[model samples]
Target: MTELPAGLHEFLSKAGWEGAEIDPIPGDASFRRYFRVRRPSGERAMLMHAPPPHEDPAPFLLVAQWLSNHGLRAPEILAQNPREGWVLTEDFGNDRMRDWLDENPDGEESAYAGAIDALVELHRQEPGPFSPYDMPTYLRETSLLTEWYAPAVGLDVDVSGYDAAWSEALEPMLARQKPGVTVLRDYHAENIMLLGDPRMGAPQGLIDFQDALVGHPAYDLVSLLQDARRDVSEDLERAMLSRYAGRAGANEHFEADYARLGAQRNAKIVGIFTRLYKRDGKPRYLDMIPRVWAAMERDLAHPALGPVADWFARNIPDDLRKSGGGTIK
Candidate 1:
């Protein structure tokens, strides 16, 4: 029997779940860990362990309450020990949107449509209190590609030049954002859940949203449509975009914003995936880099990305673009 961490054991005991069955749940890229707890009465709950100095539970608690208060289906907090970085939240079950799409391939359209509807509804809400995803944030995120990924591919370019080019390319787009909406930085299939009933009002349940920010509405939309882990079919992507545009009353520059954000996001992911391998020793993320690069190429084709596209061409040779230990094409 794996002994529970001292703090976790104490927290469970204090929460009146002393004899509960605690089973470790699969983890994500972050430092946090999760476990499923089953009480003697057959009730289930989720225990989140985000060890301090690395991960904090306060942001999760704040965002979860804000989301729940706004009528969204974020998990309810049952108990908490912020100082020790522990949280007991209502169990949302194991029906992740990614698993649902895999199990029912033909249901992509409906699943994505439901997600789009939820996004539209979320955008309708008044902006919440969150950090703004401004030019500095955008630039810092994109720098990961050059900082970590460039060296991985054997190209040591000037970091200053790279930053300058991105600033030139991304500044105008960031400035034009219209009174930003609440942007869930990771709003893809893996972070979403399907509630499966219209009576529940919001058919989607949200998770992994502690990193929410106030940014362009197009940011989250692009995150869903151009997902790094899953292949969002082109047809479905277009359909969902149109759905969001109509429902959100998007302006003429929506397409430009979407494409630019997508390009910026993919660039950041490419760097992040590489760093995950080099710094964290998680090499599996490298396999996903090729797909991410392909997506970035698609986004960079947009005219607004000329400066960024040119930078990529000049710095990273075509053959060195792919990162997953695969042969450079």
Candidate 2:
């Protein structure tokens, strides 16, 4: 058996999970690790190990509490040692929406509808206590494409023009975000677990939202529909977007906001994925850049993105953009 981390036994014992069978679970692109803790009495819980200096469990705990209090299905915290970065929470099981959709392709529409409904429900709640996803944050995230991906691909991008274009194009979107709602920054299929019915408005188990922010309602909607890890068909995307707009009483600018956020988010992902591969030695992430690039391309076509789109056309050549700058290495 693989050895456990320092203080693991003490923490589990204190939590009454002594002698449990702990097994590793696949992790994401962060410095956190998860374990399935099966107690001798047959209870199951999840253990999150977020080492200090690189990760913290405080934000996750806070967001989880906020989500649960708001009628969402975020996991319940059974025990915690935040200073040491260990948390024991109720198990959410393995039926991730992404994997479930892969197995039962016929249920895609219903699953997406449920996901959309969940977002609508979340948007109905009062904003959480979090920092705003303001212009500086958005601009910093988008700059990753120029900072990392451009350098990797041997492209000399016009950084000033890029920033200027995004600023002009994103103003309207940001304006709508005033008195923002709680935006689950990484609200995508992979982060959602289908715990109940897959029909419309069904409950989903939310996770990986430690980075949640107060932002525009359209941000999370775009995150879900324009997923980077898997393919979301254009028809489904359109249907879901319409469903959200209708249910949430979205105005005429919602589509434009969605497109702007999508472009910004996709650009950020392309850079983050590239950084993961080049700097962190996780080459697998590079495979997803092409999909994100395609989504970004579509988002840039929107008139709301005219300025930013022009910047891309002038700086990033067609061939370079097509390859997503991932084929460099």
Candidate 3:
């Protein structure tokens, strides 16, 4: 990026770093981009490439510092190029929970269990400076999934009822969530890493977290257990939930709230998968829509989601029970 930003190469050389290799990490929904830098001493660092005015690294940098101060391993910010909106961060490596799951299919539960612990620990952190992950913003963003599925396989049925059910379900559910510290908003498969530390425990490396937001306590849990990109087995999902519930000291009320929140999250994921396929031209996310739907259906079976469940039953096709299974929203 612009000839390695003059003087930086000299700095790297002086720091005993070898040549910088640009390993372009995959793109996320936001404008931010990432690259991994392999150093001479086997030390790896990541370079965030947010092209100019769109996304400032200030918030990310700020949060990283805040988290690290709390004894959390949120990449050490080694260097920065403010004008380019680029920052060099300690590489947590590529062994994300998802990668570990994919690469070692047998121990998925252990890895996920560790992730749940990390989330519980993350939530346990003392309240800090984090921005709100507004409910309105979530609602708006979640609609992208519905919007995506609506046109993908072509369905124009009045989704007003579906929308209404979502709103109804989220009202009490969101109210139950205590929006305390900055929730990483995304605490799912890809962001969490398997670390070697007993303290951070569970698994270790985490990435793709520039979109962190202070949000509902249930938000990140739902994000992890009901991931849009992965099919966490039913048994594993249950076990992980139990672990998180125990750590959070969640009671009956919290259980109900967690299930309801799961519904909201899955619904949002369904819409997001559809949107990724149709709008973002990223069909890789399409296949996972059904699982998201399945997760929603499971949650819909809960008594607390009666009205919403009934609405979905009456409107959405049984085959399409999970977001896009029926080729409609």
Candidate 4:
């Protein structure tokens, strides 16, 4: 286990877990870390250690309260000290959807179906008090590709054209943000927990959602279907898309919108993964960039991404595009 962050003992003492056993939970791409907290009384919870200056626990608390109040399964916050960035939340146990599906590959459809149902249910309501997923945010995210991935791979591409292409491509997605739903930005397999029986319907716990935003409904769906860390089959992808569209009463333009968001998101992930390796000195993330790159290429093929696709064609050659992941030499 990694060294416990400073102030952890004090934080736990204030929350009434003075001598509790603390075990480290593996972290994600961000600076935040998690630990499984167990008390002498057999009580259990999770400690989110989000160090300040890089992470804030306030949004996690807010979103947790909001999701809980709305009958969703976000982890309940037992205690919080936002100033020090410590939050004790309900422990959802350890059945992550990704690992579970790895063992039970046959359960893929059921798990994805449950996830889709949750999204459909969530999107039925008005968005919570959060910032909009506007054009500026989209552009900033897409620029990660040029800012990090392009340069690391030795491509001196036209940054202006890249931005312009995304600006043109993402306009329609921005236009559909009226009364948006809360998009759990990282709603992928790794972030979703299967609380109880894996075969059970919708008994899943949501985590790593502090970065939630009011965005297009299709964005989360894209995150789930086009996962960077795992391979969701095209057959399953198509079936789930149809399932969501049919259940949500999505418009005729939904497919195009889904493709658009998928491309934008994949682009961001590519840049983010690259940044994780080059800037943060974490090379493990490089392994996932190829998966994200492939998904981005697929999304770029959509008619909605003509400008962005053309930009890629003109600037990023086949060699750089194909060798996007670990071979940054």
**Tens-digit lDDT track of model 2 for 204-256:** 89999999999999899889989999999899999999898889888888888
Candidate ranking (lDDT, best to worst): 2, 4, 1, 3
Cα RMSD (Å) per model? 2.3, 1.4, 3.5, 1.4
lDDT (tens digit, per residue) of candidate 4 on 91-203:
99888999999888988999999899888888987898888888889889989989998888788999998998888888877778777899989999998999865566748
TM-score of 1: 0.94
Please give me the total number of clashing residue pairs in predicted model 3.
12
Instruction: Tell me the lDDT of candidate 2.
Output: 0.90
**Model 4 TM-score, all chains together:** 0.97
Against the hidden true structure, what lDDT does model 3 obtain?
0.70
lDDT of 1: 0.84
**Candidate 3 per-residue C-alpha lDDT over 1-329 given as tens digits, one digit per residue, 9 for 90 to 100:** 33444455554554445497657676657677777778556668887766568888887787788777876668888887656676788887767777777777867766777777777877788656766666676667657645766566665655677667667776776554554655776778777767653233544755556667776677778888888778877888788888988887775677677777787777677777777666667767766777777788888888878877887667556655533466632
Model 3 spans with C-alpha error above 4 angstroms: 1-19, 28-30, 197-203, 322-324
Mind giving the per-residue lDDT tens digits that candidate 1 earns over 205-305? 89999999888998998899999999987888899999998888887788887889998999899889888888888888877887888888888898888
Could you tell me the lDDT of residue 100 within candidate 2? Answer: 88
**Model 2 spans with C-alpha error above 4 angstroms:** 200-202, 324-326
TM-score between candidate 3 and the true structure: 0.85
- For model 3 the local lDDT of residue 21 reads 61
Cα distance off (Å), candidate 2, residue 40: 1.9
